[model samples]
Target chain A: MLSENSDKIQLFKYLEGIFTELEQQKIALDKSAIVAFTDIKGNITYVNDKFCEISQYSREELLGQNHRIINSGYHEPKFFRNLWKTIARGNIWSDDIRNRAKDGSYYWVATTIVPYLDASGKPYQYVSIRFDITKQKNQELELVRRSKQLEDFCFIVSHNLRAPLSNLLLLTSMIQESDDSEEQKELIGRLVKPVHLLNETFNELVESLQIRQDTDIEKVNLSFKDCLENAMEALNVAVLYPDIEVHHDFNEVPDLKYPKKYLDSIFQNLLSNAIKYQSPKRKLQIRIKSYLREGSTWLEFADNGLGINMKVQGHKLFGLRKTFHDNPDAKGFGLFITKSQIEAVGGMIYAESTQGRGTTFFIKFNAK
Target chain B: MPNDPMKTIDTLYLIDDDDTYQFIVQRTLNSLNLVNSIKLFSNGKAAIDFLEATLHDIEQIPDVILLDLTMPIMDGWQFLEQYLRFRPRIGKKVVIFVVSSSIDPRDMQRAKSISEVTDYIIKPLTKSKLISMLHESLES
Candidate 1:
């Protein structure tokens, strides 16, 4: 009898040791992971300290709330529905989830949710474990953006660069075959225009490439008037006739911290476009204004020239190689590059126009 | 040698956005003595409008059309969709060749899938290629 009793006591001691080890493992998991428990209906029942820390919410505030409290709205409704269907059927669900913290900041988590089943094989509760994956997710997003940019670059090379180049080849071939010196001279004359166009397209490509790569280009406080004057000075001498009337108002906002080169290019392109498309019936008139609105600096350029039909051409006004007018000098690169320069710094450029009337462009700088 | 009157295309249409391409191609074809008249359009819309206006005018209708794919206002694919709708009513067999700088296999495959398109030609459209294409059109 005494030996039998001792054997039972020894078994109990071994089980106690196992139970202690399991408790230690749970504590270790709580330290390293954001762990939470929710009832079958998805109401939060319990949360670990790590969950409160990562969510940027107080334990008291998070206790009665649901996972929707931290929803980032990045996923569609179908995503959450599928997740719920899996977990409710007593299965484990795993995915990378983007969540919103209390401070409005976004975070990514690699999550696994395991359901605890009742006697009827239906889930009674779920335990979710999540690891921070924000850094990796951001890197993946950046990679996608870069690949899209590369695709656009390839398209530009094939269409824009190759178009003029093909003309050059055809022109030279025609020149070689002509026995008449007079005809040969004419074909050679045609060659000059294509060659010039090819060189210009190449330079435009290089300039745009430089703008994209110079994301961290140095910026300084610049005067609005000085930038406008520099742009005018850089323009062709023919465009600066005495009849051109210019006006400016910078009282509300005079200076802005921006890249000088980009600002100057933007001004020059807009000024030239206004001049190039001017109507013969009216004298060229340009108005420039700047103001601070809702934490952003806004600049406006309104011109009285041959305007565009907004309904027809608004969507493609900023697209590369898109031209509206039949003007011989319209290369269609100015507005495209202007947009790129503005967008690179988290700014925006848009225009409003009425056919045969005028155009007004609005630029909003990124909030400092 | 006197040129055979029947061998020459009466009216040919060149629809492309590039002015230089239009100028050079017209010049080269003019030198060939195989095309009598060449009509130029900057985009698909203008060409389609002309075709619509001249549906009954056989003299103005083109025997062959060289179409470019990329253009502002109306693209090649959009034009093809419109052309397919009105093709039967025109009552003329107008052969079309898609000439583009795009070497993309997808573009080539798409162009070939269209029954109205005779063939896809990659630019720069050379003299010998143009002659062979014209001859093929004549015989067919």
Candidate 2:
């Protein structure tokens, strides 16, 4: 009987030794806060290294304490009250929280609190896991501030510059009306050309500013055919040269919901440009067609004109104040504004050109 | 000036802010013997106020209104709005021409849209264009 009793005692000691080994392994493997306890008062009995690292307190300090040790003043009293209410009712709580460190600096953490029950199925201690995300939050805030500053700068430049520009244009008109001789008129025209150029430069600058600042998009139902008709009407006089021919194919798509005026402007600019930059050897042929693919509409304007060398001008095609063709009327603003207006309405435009062959503009629109 | 047969217009309204522009236009009209009387206003508002007060009086109404688009106190658009309101009271269809140097397509579109605007003449309004405008006005 004495030998049997000793054997039972040795077996119990062996089982206790196994449990100690398992606990040590858990502590080493876990990268999150781990706490162990019984059901009665819910006090922490065991705390891991990660728990001590996050809380900035030693295991001796946190072992007997509850979760109130790392409670940040950032959260309201109601926050903890609600948190305790959720966990006490046998529910797990997962949330993002701001916690205070030992040095009083605040840190953002994504936390998940899981409730553990004792052997009798009664509520016990909780285990929490957290990850730091303070850096990401700061970046988002900085981006918003910078965007607002850019918007303010755009508004001021647009308003102030336009006012003086309008006055200058008016003054030029009045001068033309005056009784100036032929010699004087010629000289005035020379002066006026430079003023016009200055105005064009200012317009390009404003357009660039607008492109950066104006991102809010409003959608409306618009007729594609009507937009084309309007653009043709506006450019009728300019494109009346005997060398230009415009063809349309709108059988596949009819109408689209977009910013109507912008669409017209884009069409007018591109169509006129095709005529303006036509090859001297051949007549201008602009073929406009639309097709549907993958639930989106694609419109193409293929032009037989002074084709661009992609190697040299590809990067600068849509850039502000960039002129490629030798056409005297080219202010280099048409494509820049066209692209901006297209993008502003949540559409996309791309160009494909081969030197001496022609250029084809592929515009994609999100179908309504 | 009133007895001069060549000066047919009763009152000439020059609604422009620029002193130099106003002086040049007034001098041109005087040289051409276009009007018996010339009334100059620095901006659209002063002209608007004068016209709105005298619109009911036939003797006070100007035969022509030369409007400039951009001004400080009131623009040509504001003046047009006021003129349109008092249009019927004046009895005659006052010849209104948009005299602007603005080559902006948007501005040109606006001028073309308005029925009251007889012509969308671009800047440096020449003597020949003004003469043609007068001839068309008389013929109509």
Shift of residue B49 alpha carbon in model 2, Å:
64
The lowest-lDDT stretch of 10 consecutive residues in candidate 1 chain B is B1-10
Model 2, span A202-279: residue lDDT tens: 765666557646565555776667777788788774456755677888888777767665777778888777877678
Positional deviation of residue B128's Cα in model 2 after best superposition, in angstroms: 40
Error of 2 at B43 (Å): 45
DockQ of each: 0.40, 0.01
Highest-scoring model, lDDT: 1
Backbone clashes for every candidate come to 0, 5
lDDT of 1 by residue, A70-108 (tens): 999999999999999999878999999999999999999
Whole-model lDDT, model 2: 0.69
Show pairs that collide, candidate 1: none
On the 0 to 100 scale, the lDDT of residue A208 in model 2 is 54
Query: Once model 2 is optimally superposed onto the true structure by TM-score, how far is the C-alpha of residue A6 displaced, in angstroms?
Result: 18
Q: For model 1, what is the error of residue A148's alpha carbon versus the real structure, in angstroms, after optimal superposition?
A: 0.4
Docking class of 2: incorrect
TM-score of chain B of each: 0.94, 0.89
Total clashes in model 1, counting residue pairs 3 or more apart in sequence or in different chains:
0
